[model samples]
Target: MSADKPKPAGVKIVDAAKKELMNVSAIERDGNFLVVKGKIFGTMPMTAKLSPEEARKALRMLSPGLVWFLLTFPFRRSPEPPAR
Candidate 1:
Protein backbone atom coordinates (compact mmCIF):
# COMPACT_ATOMS: atom_id res chain seq x y z
CA MET A 1 0.00 0.00 0.00
CA SER A 2 1.40 3.37 -1.02
CA ALA A 3 0.96 6.54 1.02
CA ASP A 4 -0.53 8.31 -1.99
CA LYS A 5 -3.20 5.65 -2.55
CA PRO A 6 -6.21 5.69 -0.28
CA LYS A 7 -6.97 2.51 1.63
CA PRO A 8 -10.05 0.49 0.79
CA ALA A 9 -13.03 1.38 2.96
CA GLY A 10 -13.42 -2.12 4.38
CA VAL A 11 -9.85 -2.13 5.74
CA LYS A 12 -9.64 1.49 6.83
CA ILE A 13 -9.85 2.13 10.56
CA VAL A 14 -11.26 5.46 11.58
CA ASP A 15 -11.39 5.14 15.35
CA ALA A 16 -10.38 2.22 17.46
CA ALA A 17 -12.87 2.78 20.29
CA LYS A 18 -15.84 3.79 18.18
CA LYS A 19 -17.77 1.12 16.32
CA GLU A 20 -17.73 1.53 12.55
CA LEU A 21 -21.09 1.56 10.82
CA MET A 22 -21.56 1.02 7.09
CA ASN A 23 -24.42 2.83 5.43
CA VAL A 24 -25.08 0.86 2.25
CA SER A 25 -25.90 3.21 -0.62
CA ALA A 26 -26.40 0.63 -3.34
CA ILE A 27 -26.03 -2.97 -4.38
CA GLU A 28 -25.46 -3.73 -8.05
CA ARG A 29 -24.97 -6.99 -9.86
CA ASP A 30 -21.93 -7.05 -12.11
CA GLY A 31 -21.89 -10.18 -14.24
CA ASN A 32 -21.55 -13.11 -11.83
CA PHE A 33 -20.50 -10.96 -8.85
CA LEU A 34 -22.39 -8.60 -6.60
CA VAL A 35 -21.00 -5.14 -6.06
CA VAL A 36 -21.75 -3.53 -2.71
CA LYS A 37 -21.23 0.21 -2.48
CA GLY A 38 -21.45 1.92 0.89
CA LYS A 39 -19.80 4.38 3.21
CA ILE A 40 -17.96 3.48 6.37
CA PHE A 41 -18.77 5.60 9.39
CA GLY A 42 -21.09 7.38 6.98
CA THR A 43 -18.18 9.20 5.36
CA MET A 44 -15.60 7.06 3.59
CA PRO A 45 -16.71 5.40 0.39
CA MET A 46 -16.32 1.65 0.16
CA THR A 47 -16.89 -0.96 -2.49
CA ALA A 48 -16.93 -4.71 -2.14
CA LYS A 49 -17.39 -7.48 -4.68
CA LEU A 50 -18.70 -10.86 -3.68
CA SER A 51 -19.09 -14.06 -5.66
CA PRO A 52 -22.30 -16.11 -5.67
CA GLU A 53 -21.03 -18.47 -2.98
CA GLU A 54 -19.95 -15.58 -0.80
CA ALA A 55 -23.30 -13.87 -1.24
CA ARG A 56 -25.15 -17.04 -0.25
CA LYS A 57 -23.00 -17.42 2.84
CA ALA A 58 -23.64 -13.84 3.82
CA LEU A 59 -27.39 -14.30 3.32
CA ARG A 60 -27.43 -17.46 5.42
CA MET A 61 -25.59 -15.71 8.23
CA LEU A 62 -27.78 -12.63 8.15
CA SER A 63 -31.18 -14.32 7.64
CA PRO A 64 -31.58 -15.55 11.20
CA GLY A 65 -30.92 -12.14 12.73
CA LEU A 66 -33.15 -10.42 10.16
CA VAL A 67 -35.99 -12.88 10.84
CA TRP A 68 -35.68 -12.35 14.58
CA PHE A 69 -35.72 -8.58 14.19
CA LEU A 70 -38.82 -8.71 11.96
CA LEU A 71 -40.65 -11.00 14.37
CA THR A 72 -40.03 -8.66 17.32
CA PHE A 73 -40.14 -5.38 15.42
CA PRO A 74 -43.77 -4.63 16.21
CA PHE A 75 -43.26 -5.11 19.93
CA ARG A 76 -40.13 -2.98 20.14
CA ARG A 77 -40.66 0.62 21.15
CA SER A 78 -39.44 3.38 18.86
CA PRO A 79 -36.59 5.57 20.02
CA GLU A 80 -37.58 8.68 21.93
CA PRO A 81 -37.50 11.85 19.89
CA PRO A 82 -34.65 14.26 20.55
CA ALA A 83 -35.45 17.39 22.48
CA ARG A 84 -35.32 20.69 20.62
Candidate 2:
Protein backbone atom coordinates (compact mmCIF):
# COMPACT_ATOMS: atom_id res chain seq x y z
CA MET A 1 0.00 0.00 0.00
CA SER A 2 1.14 3.54 -0.65
CA ALA A 3 2.17 5.65 2.31
CA ASP A 4 -0.69 8.04 1.68
CA LYS A 5 -3.29 5.32 1.23
CA PRO A 6 -6.02 4.96 3.82
CA LYS A 7 -5.76 1.85 5.93
CA PRO A 8 -8.50 -0.75 5.75
CA ALA A 9 -10.93 -1.16 8.65
CA GLY A 10 -9.13 -3.24 11.25
CA VAL A 11 -7.36 -3.18 14.58
CA LYS A 12 -4.05 -1.47 15.23
CA ILE A 13 -1.33 -2.61 17.57
CA VAL A 14 0.51 0.12 19.38
CA ASP A 15 3.18 0.45 21.99
CA ALA A 16 3.29 2.37 25.24
CA ALA A 17 4.33 5.45 23.29
CA LYS A 18 1.17 5.09 21.19
CA LYS A 19 3.15 4.43 18.04
CA GLU A 20 1.47 1.95 15.75
CA LEU A 21 3.40 -1.30 15.39
CA MET A 22 1.09 -3.54 13.38
CA ASN A 23 -2.28 -3.77 11.70
CA VAL A 24 -4.95 -6.42 11.90
CA SER A 25 -6.41 -7.15 8.48
CA ALA A 26 -9.48 -9.11 9.40
CA ILE A 27 -11.31 -10.85 12.23
CA GLU A 28 -13.91 -13.49 11.50
CA ARG A 29 -15.81 -16.23 13.21
CA ASP A 30 -15.47 -19.76 11.89
CA GLY A 31 -17.66 -22.44 13.42
CA ASN A 32 -16.65 -22.52 17.09
CA PHE A 33 -13.54 -20.39 16.78
CA LEU A 34 -12.57 -16.77 16.21
CA VAL A 35 -9.87 -16.09 13.64
CA VAL A 36 -7.66 -13.02 13.62
CA LYS A 37 -5.30 -12.16 10.78
CA GLY A 38 -2.74 -9.43 11.05
CA LYS A 39 0.75 -8.28 10.30
CA ILE A 40 3.70 -7.66 12.57
CA PHE A 41 5.48 -4.34 12.12
CA GLY A 42 3.42 -4.02 8.93
CA THR A 43 5.37 -6.80 7.24
CA MET A 44 5.22 -10.22 8.85
CA PRO A 45 1.89 -12.00 8.69
CA MET A 46 0.34 -13.55 11.79
CA THR A 47 -2.89 -15.33 12.62
CA ALA A 48 -4.57 -16.32 15.86
CA LYS A 49 -7.40 -18.73 16.41
CA LEU A 50 -9.50 -18.61 19.55
CA SER A 51 -11.64 -21.52 20.72
CA PRO A 52 -15.25 -21.20 21.82
CA GLU A 53 -14.31 -21.17 25.49
CA GLU A 54 -11.83 -18.41 24.91
CA ALA A 55 -14.41 -16.43 22.97
CA ARG A 56 -16.84 -16.79 25.82
CA LYS A 57 -14.24 -15.57 28.25
CA ALA A 58 -13.52 -12.57 26.10
CA LEU A 59 -17.21 -11.73 25.94
CA ARG A 60 -17.50 -12.03 29.68
CA MET A 61 -14.65 -9.60 30.17
CA LEU A 62 -15.99 -7.07 27.67
CA SER A 63 -19.70 -7.25 28.47
CA PRO A 64 -19.74 -4.98 31.49
CA GLY A 65 -17.71 -2.28 29.81
CA LEU A 66 -19.87 -2.52 26.72
CA VAL A 67 -23.03 -2.24 28.81
CA TRP A 68 -21.72 0.82 30.61
CA PHE A 69 -20.82 2.53 27.38
CA LEU A 70 -24.23 1.86 25.90
CA LEU A 71 -26.02 3.01 28.99
CA THR A 72 -24.15 6.31 29.11
CA PHE A 73 -24.09 6.95 25.36
CA PRO A 74 -27.33 8.92 25.29
CA PHE A 75 -26.22 11.27 28.04
CA ARG A 76 -22.73 11.76 26.64
CA ARG A 77 -23.92 14.15 23.98
CA SER A 78 -26.83 16.49 23.37
CA PRO A 79 -27.96 16.73 19.77
CA GLU A 80 -28.44 20.25 18.45
CA PRO A 81 -32.01 21.09 17.70
CA PRO A 82 -32.95 21.54 14.07
CA ALA A 83 -32.75 25.12 12.82
CA ARG A 84 -36.12 26.85 12.70
TM-score of each: 0.46, 0.57
Instruction: Give the per-residue lDDT digits (tens) of candidate 2, residues 1-84.
Output: 657978578678788666778889988888887898999888889998999888678777767879799789868874565699
lDDT of 2 at 82: 68
Best by lDDT: 2
Per-residue C-alpha lDDT of model 1 across residues 1-84, encoded as one tens digit per residue = 657866344433345444667767677899999898889887888899999998688777767879799899889995675799
**Which stretches in model 2 have alpha-carbon errors above 4 Å?**
1-7, 62-66, 70-84
- How far residue 70's Cα lies from its native spot in candidate 2, in Å, is 7.6
